[model samples]
Target: MTNGDDEGAAGARNRTVAVDGETFVYRRFGGTGSETVPPLVLLQHFRGNLDSWDPALLDVLAADREVIAVDLRGVGESTGRVRDNVTDMARDTIAFTAALGLRQIDVLGFSLGGHIAQELALLRPRLVRRLVLAGTAPRGGPDFHNWSDDLFDTSCLDNPTAETFISLFFSGSTDSVKSAWAYLARAGARTGDQDSATTLEVRDAQLQALMEWAIPDSSKLERLAAITQPTLVACGDNDTMMRTSNSNLLADRIPGAQLRIYPDSGHGFLNQYPVAFGEHVRKFLGQ
Candidate 1:
């Protein structure tokens, strides 16, 4: 695998894989534990590249098993026409894994990435051994489209600044605000080899997919029954984008799936409480 040195303390190598002529950029972190375990693959939030991830969470997760965080096609360093729906994105994810010869893996999908991860597991159940769905909900239901027009407007604005992220991802609580700033500082620590910002075209395409996923559909609810893989569902009590209720719905529908609700946090709760969240994830995946 083509690799680069750990740009920050995350101890991850920036790498890329060619899958069906499309180049998928990913960061590969070699965990300090057993190599026989399946790699934990991360799918990013809407409009977020690898750089948007918290090194705190990645480093903690990487301590026990190999981890790979990727940029979807047409986002950041990946090369391809951006997909318009979750299914297509899931197909691309499968192809990306196939290119790397990864037979079994665990998946952690955040926000829109969680939607794609659900589709991926349903499309190829055996490929995913376990699943982590954070700040997201299953497809379907009118309320599932609870995100307001302004939230979308602000998030998709050209050249989003730290202020935009603070508003979109965190609760208004003082602690949450402090957490957001600290998370941003760590996530932005890699000054060299930073990824390009996602374009308007990519954002529009993702928004289209999200809207479609929100349409009420019984089939989507039915598909939840098919997700027999061990699942962990996490969300903040105040996730305005996806909403906290959606997480409850997922936990209630998916048999044996565990749910975690972090108080006084928003969509970026994982970043808000990385140590606690990471430890919970470690225990879940280790089971």
Candidate 2:
């Protein structure tokens, strides 16, 4: 583990923690100022590794809080097979945090990560101080776990072409297009010791989890009431994958949850409006 004031997402060095003999690789950024505040743990979207995160957003959030981003088991530099269910993934996250000796934390999960985040909070309520879910929704919602062919066509492979990513994440607007390119550039800017892409086996496992998560028999929506933590639900108005309406569902189900929808943006709205979204997160956490 590289220590001592490593700066932004790009500057932070990778570290590992052994959880039940499996090594979990993650990065820690901006824990310098105070001990009163808990670290913010970020959960990535479907098929995302650590490098898939937006560096601009990470830097912005790290300004006020320590940020920890990790590759789940079998993804990127982490070891072990990817779990085939969200519950197991949540268990892994709990184990990872336990190994780090963190008693309390803030969670920000996006898309599939959001699903896992909900599971984590439900599975171990006291561990999470605050919750943020972006571009995601409660289980059993219409279109939940339904992936567009284009989306999988782009992300299911080891390496997605630039055009495929743009189509999957961004809207067609001129501003969205410009931001898409910029976000991709920043996400890829880290030069040394890059992580390997998601493997086909891992992707299959994740997809299976998503499919099972979407089953409506025992809806997680009903369980959202159990998640009494202060929550923030956000998404782009035009999010193609996870419909923006699901954001409303999340806010309505989780008591005291707040909602935000960026105008005319898509799945990657946070990247398009990083400064604004960053400020929102800071204010939410500060409260």
- Candidate number achieving the greatest lDDT relative to the actual structure: 1
Model 1 alpha-carbon drift over 4 Å, by segment: 1-11, 32-36
Clashing pairs in 1: none
Clash list (residue pairs), candidate 2:
none
User: Model 2 reaches what TM-score against the true structure?
Assistant: 0.94
TM-score per model over all chains: 0.94, 0.94
lDDT of 1 by residue, 1-287 (tens): 32223433354656888978889988877553233468888999988888888988887787767788888889988889899999999999999889878888899999999999999999999999999999998899447574678887787787888999899999989999999999988987776567777888888889888888988776778778889999999999999888899899888888899999999999999999998998999999999
Q: How accurate locally is residue 259 in candidate 2, as Cα lDDT from 0 to 100?
A: 96
* Model 1 TM-score, all chains together: 0.94
In terms of lDDT, model 1 sits at 0.86
Clashes of 1: 0
Question: Model 2 misses residue 81 by how many Å?
Answer: 0.4
